[model samples]
Structure formats: C-alpha cells, structure tokens
Target chain A: MSERGKPNELGEYRPLSYFQLMEVSLRELLVEKGIVSDAEVQATLEDMRARGPDAGARVVARAWVDADFKARLLENGTRACEAFGLDVPALRLVVVENTPQVHNVIVCTLCSCYPRMLLGLPPDWYKSRHYRSRVVREPRTVLQEFGLRLPEAVQLRVHDSTADMRYLVLPMRPAGTAGWSEAQLASIVTRDCMIGVAVPDTSGSE
Target chain B: MPQVAARPQYPTDHPSVPVRFAAGDRVRVRKTFPLGHIRTPFYIRGHSGVIERYCGNFPVPEELAQMRSGLPAQPLYRVRFLQREVWPDYAGRADDVIEIEIFQHWLEAVKT
Candidate 1:
C-alpha cells in the first residue's frame, strides 16, 4: 500500500537497501509469529514521526524559568523529562549543563545514538562522518564552522555518547532576556543550541 | 504489544568483578581492537585521563549489539582528557577537554 519507490519491471516495488528489505521481512515475520501486530508497528512509527526539536525547546525553556525544575533536570535528566510528559524509556539521559566556564558539546562517534525521544532524529551533520570524527578532536574548529565562537576563558568539554546513555546539552540562558515568558524563550532555543553547536539567540530571529 | 523497554538499572553488583576505579581516579584506555561491535571510539584508545565520574554498570555493548546477553554488567566511567593531549595540534584553548564514557574493560589504572 506504500507509494514510495518506483515500480519494478514486474509491477512490484522493491526496497532500496538490504536493511530496508530485512526490516520489512522482520516486520512480516514478527506479525506472522503473533509477536507484534501491524497496527502496533504503525502507531509506533507515527509516534516517532510526531517527535521533533520543539519538545526539546520546550524542556529547555522550562529549565530556564524554573530553578527547582532545573535542579531536578540536572540531577536526573530522564526523571525530570517526565515532568513534561516525555517518558524516555530504555535509555539513560545525561544532561550536562553549560556554564560560564564550561561549554558542553555532544557527539556519538561510533554511531548516531541520539536522544531521539526528546530531540527527534539528529540532523545530517550530527551523523556525518566528518562531524563524528572531527568534533572530539577539534571541537573549537567544528563549533566555529557552525558559527559558535566561544570565549578564550571558556572550556569546551565534548561528551561522546558511546554507551547505553544519551546526552543533551543544557546550554546557558542567553543574557538580556529578563522576564521573558516560557513560550517566548522556547522560540529562540533552536535545536542546534541543545546539541551544543550554537547558543540561544537573544536577537529573537528564527 | 508493549514496546520492549530496557530496565533502568542493569545489575551492577557483580561479585567476581568489583569496580576497580572510582571518581577522580586516573586511568588510561587500553589500545585494543577486538573483533566485534565496540562502543569505545578509536581516538580515546591508549589515551590517559582522569575518571570524571562513575556512570554506572551496564551490559557490554559489544555483546549486546550482536543480540547476545551481555551479562555481568561492567562499570562505565566518564573519563576526562585534555584537548591538547588528545590532539597535539588542537587549536582550541589549552584548558579545553573532552569527556568520554568508556567501559571498565577498556580502561586501565594509571598510577598518577
């Protein structure tokens, strides 16, 4: 019933990659084995599709406004995320706070195991070989290419997501945004900021 | 069917293999490339650093990736390495550093 790839000469569409074929075959086998229903798989796919950077932005905005919530978030990221009704099951979420002295950046050099439940699928650059290999080695240059120039005094700490855990950067709140509402604040906290490539823009530009 | 979720706490208290290093302990990553799925990056191999914190015990990813029961969870630690040590030609501030979560099996104690 899918309309994705072009039809083959035999009037049947084929999967593009072996992985795709394997996934389809596995799904069919699981359904046939009564392990999982097609409806359940479809619903899970829908849930994944609904997730995006907005969820992360909302969490960041709340942390910026609520001091108590921020403490809880820093202590236990997975538990605090539940306050926003975001349940990150299966994986541990580690939130590294970006302070005036310490700047935090994240990378998964082995594979793209990101916090997809909160931030959705990672950007292409996050999964790119160049970004993965270079970020850990030359974080300053990589961040600079992304237009983030850090002060000489600030220490850049790159966290490599290489285990069963995922990381999210708790970027410092931008200055000159005193008494701003959570919604207004969330609007400027871009996805790259949470990933630690950039900072929240106080200029209010999208 | 409900999604298969991983338990939050993997059994960490393995009696045979006690956690060797603690937070603030100096350590070095063993430079070895076992033939399997490894979570440790190549850059950190054979590098020296201080254990920033004890992350927790988790199933060995190498076995887990192959659908095998990676039992007897190993202690995972966040090791902090100086940027200059990691890359001699690193152009960032001398104070810059990187923290990597490496498993105990891949780490060896440094007497510093």
Candidate 2:
C-alpha cells in the first residue's frame, strides 16, 4: 500500500522531486546503516513538517496595528509568543525591529535555524547550503538574488543566528496601509521580507 | 585489528550558555581563527559596530542543529548593525539594518 504512491499533501511523494528524492535517499541510508526502523524515521520527518505551527501571521498582523504589543514582542519574543503556544523546545526568539533609518536582515550561518514557531517551515532555498554560506559572506549580494538591493547609507544589521535562539525580521509597515487591518498587513508579511530580502511596498505589495 | 570509529566526545545535544551582551550597546566582531567546523559566520567576524538592538539568547550552533530529536537548549540573540558601519561604501538607503545572531563570547564592547 505504501509503495502505491498515494502519500499526501501538496503532492504525492515522488522520488523525482528534489525533496522526495532526498527523503528516499535518507530512508535508504537509515535502513542500510541499521540506524532505526525505516518507517519510523520517515514518519517523524513527515510529521514535523506536516504538524508544524502555522506561520504566526496572526500575531505579526496584530503587532502591525497594536504598538504596545509590538513593544512587548520586540522585548520578549518567547514570552510574548507564549500567548499562541508556538514555542520550540530548544529555540529562543529574537525580533529585529525595522526603523526609518535601519532595516534588518537575518541569516542562519550554521544551518536553517529559523523561528519556526512563528514562520512555519523554511523555504527550500533557505535549506540550501549556498544560502547559508553565501548569506554571511555577501549578504547584500545574496539579498539581491531575492531582488533586494539596499542603499549604502542605511545601516545594515546582519544577524547570524547560529544558536538555539532563532530570529524573525520585522518589516517596516508600508505606507498606504490606511485603514488596513492587522490581518491584512500580516498577509503581506511574506517569509522573504522577514528574512530581509524584500521590503514592504504600500504602493504595490508582495 | 580493524580500526573502529570512536563516537564524538561532544555532540550537538551538549549543553551550552546564554549570550552576554545587551541591546543598544556597541559591539565589534572579534577576529577568530576558523576551525575544522564552525557556526561563526565569516562576513562580520572581524568588523565593528554598535548593538542597535538585542535579540534573545539561544544554544550555540556547535551542538544544536544536528540533535536527533532536538534538545532543550540555550537561547540565541538577534544583533543589529548599520550597513554603512559594516561596509564603508554603503550609501545611505534611509533604512538598512544588518541583523545577525552572535553568541555571548563573540561580542566585545567598544569604548569611546
């Protein structure tokens, strides 16, 4: 039954697809090495990705409208995020605020250490070693890959979170958001902006 | 006798510490010798700037990411920087912050 290719979600587990292929290879390795029951490892990884929390879009949207709450989130991310029960066992939170004179860029040097409690699963590119290695070596260049080119004067704060504490990049609210609710704003807070590749555009949004 | 591989003395689940710096304080990236494997990023390892903000603490990457089931570990921080400060050629873009994570030991206070 398992071999019939009726997996689940987004699409069936096709070995031709990159992620699926990788999973297949890992399963083979686990079995070949006698590390664990082949079925057990596969189920675990699938469950982690499937059951992970939804990107904390609700809170981000709320913070856009609620100043006091934003302040609290900026100060204590873990504690503030507790309201949503999105805490990771070994993870800490760092919320980088965007100001008129400063923008924030985040990168995980060692691996993909993201604040999954709020952001959900990381994008495929983030998992690539190129992004992890290149982001630290040339952040601006890497950002440019995502269509972001920062001007020279704006101070670039490069955050390299390589520990248990993960980071979230708070985007400056785009203008023309007049009367727009937090829910609407959070929808615009895509994973890219949170990672410092793109900025919010009120005139035209992502 | 066939050589048997010895297990790693320190694995990713090993315990670690909390960061020691605060937000709004000035910090410079210390010059560190690269090792066989490391979590310290290279771009700003030897640079200097003010700690525009303080992110929370977390476990050092040396032992966090690869944990089998993931371990309950230390906190991490999100340190901010001015692009102009980091790169001399950086032109004022009105808003450009380089937000990165660095553990406690990698930071040093800058004196006036």
| CA displacement after TM-score superposition, residue B62 of candidate 2 (Å) | 4.9
At residue A127, give the lDDT of candidate 2. 78
- How displaced is residue A194 in candidate 2, in Å? 1.6
- Lowest lDDT block of 10, candidate 2 chain B: B1-10
> i-RMS, every candidate?
2.1, 6.8
lDDT tens readout by residue for model 1, A34-101 = 99999999898888878888878888999999999899887778888887797777757788899999
Candidate 1 segments exceeding 4 Å error: A1-4, A7-15, B1-16
Give the alpha carbon lDDT tens digit for every residue of B12-110 in model 1. 454324578776778899998888888888888998998877767777888788897777778787789998998889888887898888888998887
Tens digits of lDDT, candidate 2, A1-206:
14524555766765456765676687778789999786787686676667432355566776788888788777767666776565545546667777776667777766777777567788888879898776654677777788887766556666776544567777887778878876678767777778777886655552
Give the Å shift of residue A79 in candidate 1.
Answer: 1.7
How far out, in Å, is residue B42 in model 1? 1.3
What docking grade applies to model 2? acceptable
